[model samples]
Target: MAYNPSPKSKAILDQAWDWIQSVEYQVTVRWVFYRLLQDGIYSEKKGYRHLLSLTSKARKGFYADWRPWTLADDTRAPVLVQRQGFYGLHLRGHGFQDEDDWLARIKEEINCPLDRWASQPIYSEIWFEAAAMQGQFLHYANENMPLLAFRGDISIPEKWRSAERLAERYQDLGAPIHIYYFGDYDPKGLLIPASAWRDILAWTIVILNSKGLTKLEALESLNFHR
Candidate 1:
């Protein structure tokens, strides 16, 4: 008979999932676990043990039952594995005119409220070159809803400038300032979200899977243990 995850393991997994979805938390499994352990959300020993056990199960083919993985298979590690399962592998094609054009599209998609005085509009988009695996993102806001913006190939400096300018413009018009990015899954991709939104629109930042339409099904496959 196969060993079942304990209730404690289930609790850890649930907490891990919530952290994974948090805009304030780092998107990597290492960082997530590190922060969780630091916050007393879970003990370091328990967290490490759970990850090790999951890894062992994966190696023995207990999770999938057909193919065995190695202990060195970093991709199967719990938190990072789940993050990859959630965001990686969904490649997106590039289709933005330029930075301004990209920003305009996001504003339109999320409906920026530059004309409003109370709240701002929220908007978000993923930018990537499907063929090359190079990708990035940006976000912006208006008066009514927090408008998230994204650009695939832009630089960090440029992203900052854009966000500042957008905020200034919205504030001048009596609109609330809001903006953020849903970053890519890897380390480099991780920096994009961190740099683009940092303190200005920090509350709105997120890490999202950019793989569009047809790729959604592929995403679903990652959830399957077998």
Candidate 2:
């Protein structure tokens, strides 16, 4: 059955919808609730719950002209596709005249690639404790370096995945991996990088054992900095 919001609820939904549309980056429902709270629209826990309920209803097509894509939860998104824009159009003032022209240009661009970090001594990545701040970091981060948001203490699976990537890259490129972590100065923040590094090293050791590298040797190339 379709949900029908009350007149008051509809007004709130309208505001939330407008706010969501105004932002360029995708936002989680929790983030949206907090943002609304900061605007003095919501005060207590009950209000937060109400916003969640209304967001669910709006995304489910309970309201007219509201689509599911309007509110995206990146954490639960099954498949993510990168939207690659053509900046060349801005410079040339005319995009490809036809489909064939576009394809030809794409093929040429793919074949002739510019290696930005080829001469760099080390591979670097920036990690954030708050996932929502990723968009801010992405705005300034270099295209070559990855920006990861741990959301808190990094998970075991994520640590293992990072370890695998680091190990593989270290072995292939013979270069070091430097991680620059950003977080608060609280107790958890102070210890999270160390804890995450330890786990990653443990996983790396296991993975690199087959290559006849010891724990100390593997640790040499994986540098973690705050």
Candidate 3:
């Protein structure tokens, strides 16, 4: 009596599961549909309609709970007259250092001013076009993996500022930053992958230069949806 994902549905589910496990977050229904189109599982014309049907069927007291999940909000749309499901992701950092030790010892050393950034290892980051994707696509693949990040469809002033500050803090460490982005294929969507990286780099230079950290450059990589 339970719903089993057909081969077609399973293909999309596989991607979602991978993303959810890697990024330690859940995927929104919108994200699922968009990703399906991106992966060529469904044509634009068919993907939207197909996903809508699948999700609708899932909401109608389907046997399989994971077929379509919805967070509980009595006032929210897609009104759930009955039933609920459980999903979880585990993505805690593996750092052994405790907060006390960080403040009492390593904080100053790590935060100290530096002169160059060439010696540091390459850092990689990932961004998704949609903000909701942040949960399942923002973190690193593992604790040892390079840094990963994300932003909403548009820029956020605080997020940018925070990035700038981090860049300044590590200016002398010589780490090169790389970024990977996931998004739609629209005119604006295509530009964001590159633009977001540039904005931070430019801001980093300005802010670090203000602090007298001159003659420093961070190698960076930016790739986005086509």
> Which candidate comes out best when scored by lDDT?
2
Candidate 1 C-alpha lDDT tens digits along 1-226: 1445567765655565566566653244455567568768667556765554553443232333311211222232243222224223322353566989867876677543344443434222233323133212222322234333344434333344444544344334433333333445787776655543442232111111221313333232211010
TM-score per candidate, chains pooled:
0.23, 0.52, 0.36
How would you encode candidate 3's per-residue C-alpha lDDT over 9-111 as one tens digit per residue?
A: 7666556455435544544555666766777777775567676556543432242444223312112235234332321222343232777864665445545
Go through the candidates in order and give the C-alpha RMSD of each one to the true structure: 19.7, 12.9, 17.8
Clashing pairs in 3: 117-174, 118-174
Evaluated at residue 226, the lDDT of candidate 3 is 27
Number of residue pairs clashing in candidate 2, backbone atoms closer than 3 angstroms, sequence gap of 3 or more or interchain: 0
Whole-model lDDT, candidate 3?
A: 0.50
Report the C-alpha lDDT of model 2 over 16-115, residue by residue, as the tens digit: 8778778898666777787778887888757877887687666543377564455655365333343347533233334568999878878877655665
Q: Pick the candidate with the highest TM-score.
A: 2
